[model samples]
Target: MKGMTIIVKTVSSWIKVLVFLFGIYIILFGHLTPGGGFSGGVILAGSYVLLLLAFGREYAEENLPLPIASKLDCIAAFLFIALALLGFIYGAGFFFYNFLQQELMADCNAAGKLVSAGAIPLYNIFIGLKVAASLFLVVLVLSAFRSESDPTEGQE
Candidate 1:
């Protein structure tokens, strides 16, 4: 990478890390807080965009590898849908709240805490992963194809 590219990459990588951490925090505290999977996923995707802007499309593609990201996205989507469907087996509606009365469960307040909700937390995780991965992959792939035949256009 060029010196400018290196600087951009470093700063962008730090931003991405911060964005990822914020996304995790949002997802974990989603039940008790305002942000959730969708918001966090958008933030996570923002990191990838930063990377693309800083390093160029080729760098992002080489690092993220479109095929693997695609597969992960598919699997995450399937798992999310499956989890929603699982509620039907317990006589609950789709995406219903079916609490497990296990002793290992965390204590919950009336308004609910970060660890209070059962499936909600798990669902947020799934949605977060799916959204982040999918958005990252999508942006990467899109950037990969954005070019003119000149070849020197994105050389910086």
Candidate 2:
């Protein structure tokens, strides 16, 4: 009653999972593929946006509350900064250096492994989280606003 019909809700529920998975895939394999943190984060936020559209703001808020999203955004930012600064502590002597790559270089051939990119993947993960949370918050806030008469009522 508060949102679209049951058919839309059910379909959105199913599709959201796939979208979320695709976003994770993009974030994880971004170093190898074209899509990365920013694109994947947008895709991730879009999954929640689809839910909000199909199930209403209240339902979406219940699943991912504003406070939790806010905290996630902040935590992700801190982690990204920490990852960058870790290079300094590890004698990389530069911000955003590939410190992990250096250590792994002596271990084995990292030609096609997941850990090959090292800090890049970590950065992507944190960046993906931050972007997803930020975009979702924006859409959620925008969705909260509504005119009294309803925008669709007086239209043809």
Listed in order, each prediction's TM-score against the native is 0.78, 0.89
Which prediction has the highest lDDT against the true structure?
2
Cα deviation of 30, candidate 1, in Å: 1.4
Q: For residues 54-107, what per-residue lDDT tens digits would candidate 2 score against the true structure?
A: 988888899899999999999999999999998887745888787877765558
Candidate 1 lDDT at 57 equals: 72
**Against the unseen true structure, what C-alpha lDDT does each candidate score?**
0.71, 0.88
Give me the runs in candidate 2 sitting further than 4 Å from their true place: 147-156
Candidate 1 regions with alpha-carbon error over 4 angstroms: 1-6, 91-95, 100-111, 148-156
Q: What is candidate 1's CA lDDT for residue 37? A: 82
How many residue pairs clash in all the candidates, one count each?
0, 0
Positional deviation of residue 87's Cα in model 1 after best superposition, in angstroms: 0.9
Error of 1 at 123 (Å): 1.2
